[model samples]
Target chain A: MDEGSAALVAAGLGKRYRRGWALRGCAVAVPRGRIAALVGPNGAGKSTLMALATGLLRPTEGTVAVRGKPGFLAQGKPLYQGFTVEEVLHAGRALNPDWDDAYARRLVAEAEVPLGARIRTLSGGQRTRVALAVALGRRPEVLLLDEPLADLDPLARQEVMGALLAEVAEQGTTVLLSSHVIADLDGICDHLLLLSGGRVQLAGDVEELLAEHRLLIGPRELDVPAAAVVERRETGRQSTVLVRGLEPPDDAQAHEPTLEELALGYLRAGRTSGREVAA
Target chain B: MTWVAWRQQRLLTLVSLALVALVGAGMAALWADLSSVLPADPAVLDERYGDLLGYVPFVMLAMPVLLGMFAGAPVFAREFEQGTHVFGLTQSIGRTRWWATKLLVAGLPVTVAMALLGLLNAKALGPLSSILTSRLQTPMFESQGYVLGAYTAVAFALGATAGLVVRSTLGAMAITLAGYVGVLAAVANLGRPHYAGTEYSASGAVEPGAWRVEIGYLDAQGATTTFAGQKCGETPIAQCLLDQGVAGRFARYHPVSQFWEFQGAESGIVVLVVGVLVAVSAWAVRRVH
Candidate 1:
């Protein structure tokens, strides 16, 4: 990818804690104006990547850079519990030179959050909305959100995502959103960057990537290229195989895989391969 | 950034100021009472204010560490606890500015207020110096004059820096308390007397407000000598001392004139320590996350 067209780019980015490397040999380029889903299992370094991109964590090796100003909604959406919503907005204005106070206040009003209420008194959904307002107040060109929907109920998740998508659409801001649940990001994201075991497992335009892969169901003895097979499951005499860049045999039924199917296949493959690599 | 920091620290700063104001008011009342009764007998002054002197030192000495633990420890530790530090750090402001603003906003008001209270304390206690023990001693020296503000600065710096290092409010508070007391004791015992030279008198006669550090015997040659005499059963103490070949008693002391000099020396050292703590805090903040 052209570096100028990428809003967030990392080449061989790695971060090591005292125990071991949390992320290593990772490379990803999030294209400008695209919402990229950063899907990974717990401890898969999804949060680590977002933090590095936001300049929160220094990479122990390699380079990571964000093109323009960036805003981050950290995991748990942390805000000052003692501060009222109005004061929280004031803090956003105080901390960011490019802050848009009116826009922030409008977002809060749209969320129906009272300006006088302290953060601790707000519901979880309300708190997330307030935090999103603060993050968006800076009018950042690139926004990184880590596990933003983890604690929300299904309805609040939809509302938050809807509100976030509306703003992104209006502003044309690039976003890299991390989540463990692939279902949450299935239809919203245009790009996919999957991480597992501190490395990028798969990264590409979601539609094109999904189109190139097929899920095949047939007899257990079905033939396919070993290199193209991502994951295979067998039940009695039947086989379900996920393959990339492969043609299906005449005996099998084939169809393009859903995003969840594609992600789960790669995650399972990564787990088995990670054990092999460890050995 | 300053506004944000001040908002976060508003409650603790106000509480600390209120505490200092309360103490100042009490001290002002005492100063008025003491000023009205000056030139009176020492016994009369002692009778009126002796009980107060016993507890004032403890209260005054405790104020700095209390402000440090309450105001300074939570400046960063509470942010870490609630995870708001990530929010603060990711903003447009740099980490150094964030650290500095928080430290200054939370630490300055209380430190200045304590300094004013210290001046008031000196005024209130100045008239009682002759009736009490030397003002250069532990609780007395520490409770009044410029050292109070200096001690407050050190405690506040220690608490703020410890919060960054430990990342827990209670842990930081414990460290601040322990570290403040440790520095206080170390300075008093090891650093105070050495601030200036001590005067030696062979007759054991010191000025009214001088601090007598040591007392020993002198021989005919005017050198310090150890007592080698046995216990006297019936003889007078002076006769027994003469028989034992003791010439005179000598005193090693710091005169009343050295009070301000000692204050300046101790405050200088404490200010230097505060500088080191602030530098560490700045370094630690950048290393966070």
Candidate 2:
């Protein structure tokens, strides 16, 4: 994608902590108006990338730029425990120059969260809703959510995602939502940016990425090009292989991979490559 | 930004101010009571108020650090602990503004309140200085002048800055206590005595309110000398000193009039430390994530 068309861009982005590099040499872009799913295993630099983009964590190297004001919902969905829901809205209004007070209140009402309720008194789902309201109130051009649904029940997860999608649709906002559970994002996200072991393992439109990869089941002795195999699993007599940009052998059964199959294949491939480098 | 910062810090600030006000009220009552007994005998004054004097200064000396630990340490540390700092920093209000606003909102009212109480303390305690230790001495010097305000400022700054650096409330409170005590002790022992030049009295007698730093014998030639009192045997120590070629006794002291000078010098040093802490806080806040 061209620079102007991308809502968020990172080129050679990296971050290092005392333990080691959390992320390194990452480059990706989410095009405007696309709901990008940042899928990765735990500690795969998902949070690091979001923080760097929001200017919370400074990059150790390279650059990350967002197109406009970015709203972020951190992994824990942190809000002031002492603040009332109303006060939280006040805080959002106080902190953001472009805060939409009425809209935030409306979101809170839709979630059925009491305006006078202290955040500490709220249920997990209520807290997440209030946090989401705060993030949405800023009318952000780009929204970066880090494990936003991690603590919610399945019902709350659906509600939160639905609310977020409705807002994004109306505003035409670009969103980069992170989660390790690929199923949560399967039907929602149009773009995919998968990370594993601190590197961008796969990034592109989801449909295109799914179309390019194939899942094959063949005999254990079946031969395939090593370079094309993303991941492979073997049973007593059958071998399941996920391959990218390759045709299947005549004797093997093949089909297009699901999003989970595609993400899991790349993540497993990235982990093995990391171990290889370590070795 | 200011409103949000104030709301977050409202409870701690109010509590700190209330504590200072309580102290101020006690000082006011004491001043009134002491005024009613003006011109009393030194012995009588000592008999009535000496025990209270011993405890009051210690309480006053402890107040600054207590406020630091409770009010200042958690300003940033609590936000970090609860993960709310990430929310604060990501807002449209820039990091510097957020930090400065919180520091000012949480720190200013209490510091000013302590300063006002300090003035009240000086007014109330002035009449009792002769019976107590010198106004230039510890506890007294620290508790009843603008130095009280300065000390509180430094403590608060130390705590707030430590919170930013350590990112833990308990850790920051511990640092604030240790750092405040170290600075206070260093200033009282090493800094106060040198604030102004000492005056020498050849007759070994200083004015009633003077802080006598040193006393020694003077030789016939007018140089400081030590007497061999053991060698004098049955001779009185005063006579033995004279016989050993000591002309008279000499005393080095800071006169009572220099109290304001000492207060200014100590307060200046403390204020400088506070400035450094504020600078450090600004730098540490930027590096928090």
Best by DockQ: 1
Model 2 regions lying over 4 Å from their true place? A276-279, B230-234
- Candidates' RMSD to native: 1.5, 1.5
lDDT, candidate 2, B227-276, per-residue tens: 77779999887788778998888999999899899989999999999999
lDDT per residue (tens digit) for residues A10-52 in model 2: 9999898887788889998999999999998998889999999
Model 2 CA lDDT for position A189? 97
In terms of lDDT, the poorest run of 10 residues in model 2 chain A is A270-279
Question: TM-score of each model's B chain?
Answer: 0.96, 0.96
Q: Residue-wise lDDT of candidate 1 within A166-188, one digit each (tens)?
A: 99999999999999989999999
* Tens-place lDDT digits, model 1, residues B172-286: 9999999999999999998999999999877999977789999999878887777755576688888887877788999999987788899899999899989999989888988
- In model 2 chain B, the worst 10-residue window by lDDT is B123-132
